[model samples]
Target: MITEFGLSELWEPETRRDPHAFYARVRAAGRPVPQVDPAGNRFWVVARHADVLEGLRHPEIGHQLPGLSHGEGEAERIASRQLISLDPPDHTRLRGLVGRAFTARMTARLEPWIAEVADRLVARARELGSFDGVADLADPLPVNVIAQLVGVPEDDRAMFRAWSATIVSASDWDGSATLAFAAYLDDLAALRRRAPADDLLSELVALEAGGDALDRDELVAMIQLLLIAGQETTVDVIVNGIRLLLTHPEQWRNLRDDPSLADAVVEETLRFRGPVEIVPPRFAFRDLDLAGGVIPAHERVALSLWGANRDPEVFADPDVFDVHRSDVRRHIAFGHGIHFCLGASLGRLEARIMFDRVARELGTLRLAADQGDFRLHHGGLPLTL
Candidate 1:
C-alpha cells in the first residue's frame, strides 16, 4: 500500500527537479497505486503504460463529477466550466467552435510569424551570450505568438505575458493567478463583443453554429484556457527539448547534422520529459477495472504520463533518450483520446521552430548550469537550456 501521503510525497521542488526516481517507486508499486494524505484522503495514480492509455480513452473517465471540486461556489465553476473540464455534448460543441478558429490556414499563417518571433528571440538570447532559455526565449515566444493571434495590443503584451506566466506557475492551491486571469479575460471578452476584429478572441466572439454561440462566461473560459494551455505547455516542451539535446550530446549531434530531426526530437522530448507530470485528474464516472485495480465511482484518478511513457512494456530501453527510436512517436505525452490536446499540432510546430532556430544560432549548445541546478517550470517539469 503506497500511502496517499507516500505517493503524493514528492514535493514541488524535488518533483520539479527530478521525478524519475519518484516515478520509479510508484511504477514498482501495484496497479492504481494508492496515495493517502495525512487526513486519510486517498486517490489512485495509474502509472502503467497500458493503464494510462486506457484511462485516457475510457468513456467511464472524465474531468467532471458532481461534488468533486477544490473549492466551493464560483471559483470551482469557473475552473470546471472551461473546456478542459467539460464532458459530452458541451465539450463537443465548444471544441468544434474553438477548433474552427485554429484551422490549418490559421496555423500556416502563424508559422512565418512564429518563425520570425523565434528568430528575434534567438538573436536576443545570442546577444546576451548566456541566458535562461525558459525566461529569455522559450517563455516569451509562445505568449507573444498567442498574444498576436488574440489581437492583444502591442503595448499590453508585456502585461499579458506576466499574467500568463503567473497562472502557469500557480498551482491549484494558489487561486490568485486563476482569479487574475479570469478578471482579465472578462474585460477582453467584453471588448471583443463590442468590436470584433480579425484575431482569435474576436473570431471566437463572432463564432456561431446551429444558432448557438459561446456565452460570456464560456467565452472568458475558452480565452483563458487557450492562453494558458496554448502557451504554457509549449514553453516546457521547447525548454525541455533544448536541455535534453544539450545533455544527450549524441542526439544533439544528430539534430545538428540534420535539422530535420527537430520533429523527432520534439516527439521524443514530449514522451521522455513531457510537459505535464500527470494528466489532470480524471474522475471515475463509475466503478471500473483499471490494471486489475477497481476504481470506485467519482473517485479522482490521475495518469502519470511521465511514468507511463517510460514503461518498459511499451518502449524498450525506455530510459535512453533517443531521437531515432522507431517507436518514439507512440508516447502519450500529448494524451491519447477524445480529450487529447487540441493544441498538439501548434505545440509541435513551435517546438520544431525553436529547435531549428537554436541549431541555427548556437551551433554547439551547452548547459550553463550543473545538471542538478535546474528548477521545474510548469509544475514538476525540469527546466534547463
Candidate 2:
C-alpha cells in the first residue's frame, strides 16, 4: 500500500495535479498513518476530520522539531518564533498583535480598493481576449494588495515581488535568501520609523499588545510571513478556485446565475482544492495518543487539511464539487483552533470580489493549458490557469 505521504506525493509533478483521490484513500483508512519524507525523517499523517482536529489542538504537538534543527543558526531560531511555527503564549501574544492590524473593519475598508484591483485586472483580461488567469489576475492581485498594506511604493512592487519570490523559494535551504529578506526588511523598517504611513506594516511596527512588542528579528519574520503568505497562498486560492469553476461548468453556471452563491462557491472551492495541501509539520513534544495510535516523543506529525475537508464521514458526496455544499463551512481550509489563518477575511474578500467582477466584467474564461501543464509549487496548489 502507498504510504499516506505517497498519497500526497510532493515530488511527482503528475501526482500533484490531483492528490485528492490519494487523500480519499487515507480517509477510507479512518486513522492516522505513518510515512517517510525525502530527508528520511519519519512522520504521522492525521487524515480523518476528527483526528486532524484532535491533533491540531493537542498541547503536546508543537511547530519545532528540535531533533531536526537543534543546532541550527540564529536565522533559523528567529524563524521558529513565527506565528505559524509557534505554540501558545508566544503564539497567542503575537497573534493578538497582528490580528488587530487586520480587523474585519480594516478588511471591510479594503473592499473598495480590492474591488478596483479586480476590475482593473478583469479589464486587462478583456483587452487580451484570452489570458492566463495566474499572470493576469490571480498572481498580481494579492501581491499588489499586500504591497499596499506593507507601504511598499507603487514604483517598487516589481522589485518587491522579486525579493518575495526569492525569499519564498522552496530551494532556499542555506538561509541566504532569508538573510537577504531580513536585510530588506531592516532597511524598510528604518524607513518606516523615519516616516511612518497609514499602512499595515507601519501599524505592525508600532503594534504593542499585552505589554509586549515584536523585536527587530521578530519583526522581520513577521513581515516575511505576511508578504509571502499574504500573497502566495491567496494567489493559489484564486487560481485554483477559477480553475475549478471553469472546469466544472455546471457549478460555474450555478454561481454565475446567483452571484450570492459566490461566497458559497468560494467556500466549496476551498474545501475541494484549498491552497495549502497539508498543514506545516508539528513535532510531538512528548509521547501522545492519537487516533488509535501512539506518537512517540519528538516524532513529526503532518495534518492533511485536504483529507479532513473531504472525509466521507463529514461531507456527503465528498468528492463532488458542489457550489452549494451545506457543510462547506465545516472545512478547515483556513485551518482550525488558535492557529487559523489571520488573513482569512482578506482572502475571502479578495476572492468574493474577484468572482463577482469576473461574472460582470470578464467575457469568458478558458483554461489556457492542460491541468497537468500547471506547476505545483513545493506541494502547494497549482499555479497555472
Candidate 3:
C-alpha cells in the first residue's frame, strides 16, 4: 500500500522535475494506489502497463459519471460537450461527425503542406543562427498546420495560439480566454455558414450525421478540443524529441546520417517522455476488481501513461533515451481506446516532417546554454544551429 503517495505530489516542483522515480514506486506496489487530489477528489491511480491498458479499455469505466453535475456556465457547458468529456452514444455520435472531417486520408494529404511548413521554419532558424527550439520550430509548426487545416485565417492565428497556450496551461483561471475563444468560434462558424470554404471548419459547419449536425456549443467545443489537443501535444513531442536528440549526441549523429530515422525519433520520444502524464479522469460505473484491487462504484480513476510507457516488464532499459528501440510502438502517448487522440495522424505527420527537416538541413544542434533541469511543461528550449 503506497499510502504516502498522493496525486497532488505530481504537481510539486521536485516531482515535476523527475516523476519517473515516483511512477516506479507506484508500479512496484503492484496495484492501483488510492489517492486524493488537492481539491479533495478521491481517486485511484493505476500504474502498471497491463493495468493501465485494461483501465483504458474497461467497459465499466467511462468519462461521464452518472448523477454528476457538470456545472452550468458558458465554459462548463462547452467543456461538457467536448469530445473528451463524453461517453458512448454521445461520444460515438460526436466523434463520428467530427471524424469525417479529420480522417486519416485527410491527414495524409497534408504531408506536403506540413513538410513545406517545416522547411520554411527550419530555413528561418538556420538563417538566424540561433533560435528557441520551441518557439521557432516546435510551437509554430503544429500551430500553423492545425490552424490552416481548421481554416483559421493567417491574421487570427496568433490570437488562437495565445488562447490555446493560455487554456492548456490553465493560466486563464478567470475563464476569460475560454469565453474569448468561444466568441471567436461563434463568429467564425457564422462566416463559414454564409460562405463555405475548402477547410475543416467549413466541413464541420456543414457536417451531418443521420440528419443530425453539430449545434453551436458542440461546434465550439469540438474546435476547442482540436485546437488545444492538436497544438499542445504535438509541440511537446517535437520539442522533447529535439531536446532528447541534442542531449544524446550519438543519436543526433545517427539521425543526421539517416534522416529516415525521424519516425524512429518520434516514436522513441513518445515512449521515453510522452507529453501526457495521464489521461483525463475516468469514472467507475460499478464496483470493479482490477489487478487484484477493487475500485468502488462512482470513484474516479487516473490511468498513468507515463507509468505504463516506462514499465520495465515492457520496455528494457526503460529510462534510457535511445531512438533505436524496437518496442517504441507500444507506448500509448496518444492514449488508447475510444478517447485515443483524433489528431494523432496529424501530430505524427507534423513531428516527422520537423524532425526530418532538422536532420537534413540543420546538420547539428546544441543547447545554447545549460537548461538546468527539464520540466514537462517548459516555455521554450534555446538551441544554436
Sort the predicted structures by lDDT, highest score first. Answer: 3, 1, 2
Please give each candidate's TM-score: 0.89, 0.91, 0.96
Q: Tell me the tens digit of each residue's lDDT in model 3 across 340-364.
A: 9898888888898899999999996
Angstrom error at residue 382, model 1: 13
Error of 2 at 279 (Å): 0.7
The clash tally of candidate 2 reads 0
- Give the best candidate by lDDT: 3
Report the lDDT tens digits of candidate 1 across residue range 6-66. 5556554666466776666667766677666456566787888888888888888987787
lDDT, candidates in the order shown: 0.78, 0.77, 0.88
* Alpha-carbon runs more than 4 Å astray in model 2: 1-17, 65-74, 208-211, 373-385
Give the range of the ten consecutive residues with the poorest summed lDDT in model 2: 376-385
Q: What is the lDDT of candidate 1?
A: 0.78
Q: Which RMSD does model 3 reach against the true structure?
A: 1.7
For residues 208-232, what per-residue lDDT tens digits would candidate 2 score against the true structure? 4334678877787787788888888
From the highest TM-score down, the ranking of the candidates is 3, 2, 1
Q: Estimate the lDDT of model 2.
A: 0.77
